[model samples]
Target chain A: MGRPSAGKSTLASHVEDQLVEAGYPIENLDGDDIRKHLHPDLGFSREDRRTNNRRTAYIAKLLNRNDIPVIVGMITPFRDSQEQARDIIEDEGEFVQIYVKCSVEAAEERDPKGLYQQAREKNIEKFTGVNHPFQEPLNPEIIVDTEAQSIDDCVDDVMTQLETLGVLDERLDDDYSFSITRSEEQDITERLEELGYLEE
Target chain B: MGRPSAGKSTLASHVEDQLVEAGYPIENLDGDDIRKHLHPDLGFSREDRRTNNRRTAYIAKLLNRNDIPVIVGMITPFRDSQEQARDIIEDEGEFVQIYVKCSVEAAEERDPKGLYQQAREKNIEKFTGVNHPFQEPLNPEIIVDTEAQSIDDCVDDVMTQLETLGVLDERLDDDYSFSITRSEEQDITERLEELGYLEE
Candidate 1:
């Protein structure tokens, strides 16, 4: 995880695709995507950030528990929270922390949302690596420099690390396939009826 | 919206069934169901709880954006969070906050997971209405007392509220529709690829 505009989401998406292509079933937990859809009530304050991290970690852990490797892309700035996440998903080799590292200057240059400009102009507060501190990882399993590396090179680095860690077994490589099965509308209807969220 | 073990899920499910029976399309975002699948990594921490709340709100917002009235069944203990959720949707009367109010004693008597017993024994921390606080709504659009209300009564209450809110327009009530016709698997794959989480 890294700061906004650090190519964390870009890197996470690329890695997810490669893993899927390689035949390992995978799920992704994009922090922004979740914010837009899943947890819209939360803000971007310190408390909200911690809350977002915890919730994302929990979702990742759940997918991992179900035998799906989860790739989480979020700006997890604090080591304490990361450690807590690691502790929560304690399955051997299940937690893989990949730090997408980049300098503030480099990140600013690639600011897709002009966030750096906003932060510099004081339009945005608590901008990580600017107004806010981004704690460096003490021992991240892998690190990818977004500014210096190409997307393909970054993907290769992650794939190499996963291979060394035995996360991508040979059987998985041979069986890399995906399917789109429609959940029966009736099933959803029945479930909604049971939950009391819908009207009878 | 209902209390724990107060048959909130049961009530929500009945409502969904009724809506479908009347030919309205619906989706259920039950807290327990989401906990099992969507957000497995989240814990009972305050931050995590808020994140979970936000995620649910976001999903509800997405459904609303797509012209589907989502039925969310989480306790959603904070009024501020609920207000923020309302702001996120901003689709007039789209959010129907239903309080499934129940007494601590009544909840303890049910003890679906022996959670109350654990809280009493000091084995569980942050138990809502026990060690932790559960802020009741000052004015929920709909309030259902699970202890005194039958499942049908609770369901009817919600159905009436939805009708009053105009969520179930005559056209929608007679149309059997599916908002998400494509499998989430494809969307997940596409998102993974776009976010660069895939290892290609």
Candidate 2:
């Protein structure tokens, strides 16, 4: 759970691709899915944000119970909302609260969607880290220092933390004994082509 | 797929167990999940039902694209809502729409939740098949005659239809050659206990 433009979606999609390529039963839960598809009528109110948090966490919990690990990229703005998500998800499976740590100035400067700029210009109301507050998680399971490190380094840090936590590599009972075994050039690429995603 | 107390849940859970036991990547997308967890405030309105249908279908499509077969057991009361779900899901993957055909008489008699009785006593408002109409799908992919057959037989019919349609058994790319490989009784039971779900 990180603030917008803190490389939350970037880090999420990268990790998600890695998991998919590895043949794991994975799902990427984003706030966008909840906001756009599930709860489109909802606005950026505190109550609405808390509701979103609970719903997404519940979804993750359900998926996790069925043995699917979900990588959720959400900007849980408040501590209460963050705690609520953690509590809901951890009830069934592990909830890895990742803080994509980036300064508001850096995030604002690097805003790809210009959301930060919009917030600044008063185009968007109740935007986190502008009119609204973005509370830093008191104790996040993983903290990716996006401002200080490269994307690869940030991803590696999160992956390493995941390993340390014993989340382990899982798929359709295709246990990989922890890490990616086939490295050394040509083999890994060929292996990816062999295993297909669900669309096929 | 079927109305309330039409043995939809029973059939869904049975099929779900079979898939999980065989180490398949599966998720059961139920209307109950949306109504209870995601949109608790939503009432038994036409718009609410359609919104619920679309949201569940979207969730199913996302999972299906990632290679998971979702058994969605929803009482899609209108053909438009049913068509909407099919369109959303089939955009990415196969959608098997099954009709658990149980007459209102049989369903009311077998109302496990006493929902029908409540609806009759005016305790529940806008209940499907009570005050509201349940428009059957024009042409469902499968129809299990729950009124005529036993639960086991009904399950068999649905499974047969699934196989016929080539909605082939899928898991984490673990290609099973069209059927359950080792089903000699003792071996199957042991296999389920070994291939642990996500909670483990």
Candidate 3:
């Protein structure tokens, strides 16, 4: 969890891709994508933010229940909210909070949406570290400083952490091999038919 | 949006049943089910609640995009989140915000989870009305008073609203028939086998 344009989404997506490549069933819950698709009715107020946070955590928990490790990327600005998320998951130490730290200067330079510039120009209000307050993480399990670190380095750090946690194992390799032989294409077509997307 | 134990889930399930029975593809996104299955890590804090609301909306929008009307039951306490959800769907008036309006007394009386009793005993903090705030809808599309109205009445009201909103074509007879050819099942089975779910 970090401010917008902090490379949180990028980092999480990279990690998800790596995990997928390593043959683990994974889901990346990106905040923006979710906002557009899931909770379009909510706004960026304090109350709305809390609701958004809770919903995302609930999705992560669901994926976890399905034995899928979910990598979530959101501008979760509150420590209390994060703690609440951990409590909801109930699977102790499974919820890894990775703080993608970056300086305001660096974030401004890398503002893909030009949001920081808009915030500075007073075109956007309540921008994190500008008009809105961003509560820094007191003690996140992992910290990746986007200002100094390369994407590859950040990915490597996350991969190393996953290995240390023993979340990935030889079973993943076996699953990949098994999946290649399994008929996934047939399953997709059958599912499509069951949903009435296809006819006789 | 209303308090937990306010019959939100029960009502949504009923509505979904009616829609499906009317030959419409329906999906129900219940808060409890989502928390248990999708977002195991999320809790019921202000921020967390907002996130939850947003995520539900996102899923609803996705279903809507696929021409499926999703019925979601959540304690969305804030209006901003609801508005955001509308924006995400982009289709004007597609989001039917049915405020399951019920008094705290009524909710407590129907306390299926014993949550209200706990809240009254101060065992739980941030209990919708007992501890936390619940913003009443200023202009909800439909208001179902569970305390005064019968389940049948409530269901009828929703069905009428859906019809009025053109969600259900009233002209279509209740006994409208569609041919269910056995060959369709054979085709689906063949597709499933191709997908590798069935043995060749």
Candidate 4:
């Protein structure tokens, strides 16, 4: 979780693509995507923000429980809301909270969505790190300082954390090592093409 | 989807359990559960109901895109919202609209959540089928008449629909015939026990 323009969605999508390349099926749950499709009526009120975070958390937990890892990118500003999500998801699967740290000034200068300008101009209400406060996570599993690191480096940091947590490269046993073979890759590609999910 | 006490959750959960038993990992998106955990700020307003339905549909689409089938049980009172859900999900995966049909009288009589009585006594506002309207689907993929059929029969009807849609028991080609055998089951059970998800 991080402020706007901190590259949360970019990092999450990068991780999802890398996981797919590693033969792991994963899903990208972006805050903007969820808001566009799921909770269009939700405003930026505190209650609405909490509800949206909880919504994303519930979907992530469901996907994780089904053996599909999910990369969630959201501005989970409230500590309580983030903790609530952790409590719910950690019951079924691991909840690795990654704090994408960036200064408000840096985020405003980046202005990825122009949201910071809107908040600065008083055009938007309850904007995180602008008008509203964003409580930093006290105990995040990983912290990638966006101001000091490139996007690739930040993604590498997250991947390293996941590896340490035994999420990626989970070797079952010496006798049961698993890896994607050339034929399996070809089969997956063929299936994707047949399903119209990809072009031949 | 049907009225508040139309037994949608029970039916959906049963179907999910059956799918698990059939070696398919599935997720059940329940209206009440989502309201409790995800959409706590949502009320019975028409806009809120539409947002909730769209929210569930988005999550279902995400899960389905990740190769996990989803069974959604929501009192989707608006035809436009249902159509919107179909449009969103059908783009990625199959969208089977199951209209669980039951009489308003029967639903009120069941009063599963005691909500029907509240609606009848004017204690609840914007209650679907009482204070508000529940627009029936113009062309649902399947219709299970809860008033006429037993729960088992209703589930059977849904299973048959899925089978006809080629969603269930899809024994893949010989080249990729994947199934969990007895030893695999034992291994999985042992892993779950070790992970403290099952009794030791």
Best-matching candidate per DockQ: 4
**Whose TM-score is greatest here?**
2
Q: Tens digit of lDDT per residue, candidate 2, span A1-200?
A: 77889999899999887766655668887778768977788898998888888887887887776767999899999999899888888899988889999998999889999998888889999999889888999999899999999999988788778766757433322554445432321265666667752234
Kindly list the per-residue Cα lDDT of model 4 for residues B45-135, writing each as its tens digit: 8888887887788778888888788888998999999899999899788888889999999998888789988887999989999989999
DockQ, 0 to 1 scale, candidate 2: 0.40
TM-score of each: 0.51, 0.83, 0.50, 0.80
Predicted candidate 3 versus true structure: per-residue lDDT over B69-160, tens digit per residue: 67788888877877766676665227777889889988899899999999999999888888987888777778888888988898888777
After TM-score superposition, what is the CA distance of residue A49 in candidate 4 from its true location, in Å? 2.9
TM-score, candidate number 3: 0.50
lDDT of 1 by residue, A26-99 (tens): 66768778776666777878877777787677656644544557788888898887887787676433777898
- Distance from true position, residue A141, model 1, in Å? 0.3
Residue-wise C-alpha lDDT for candidate 3, range A1-200, written one tens digit per residue: 88888899899989988777756666677899877766667687776777788877766665554455678899888777888787766663377778899987888889999999899999987777888878898878788888889988998887777666555553444655543212243477679999999896
Candidate structures ordered by DockQ, highest first = 4, 2, 3, 1
Fnat for candidate 3 (0 to 1) = 0.40
Sorting all predicted structures by lDDT, with the top scorer first, yields: 4, 2, 3, 1
DockQ of every candidate structure: 0.15, 0.40, 0.21, 0.66
Pitting candidate 3 against candidate 4, the one with the higher lDDT is: 4
Task: Tell me the lDDT of model 4 at A6.
Answer: 87
Interface RMSD of each: 8.2, 2.2, 7.1, 1.0
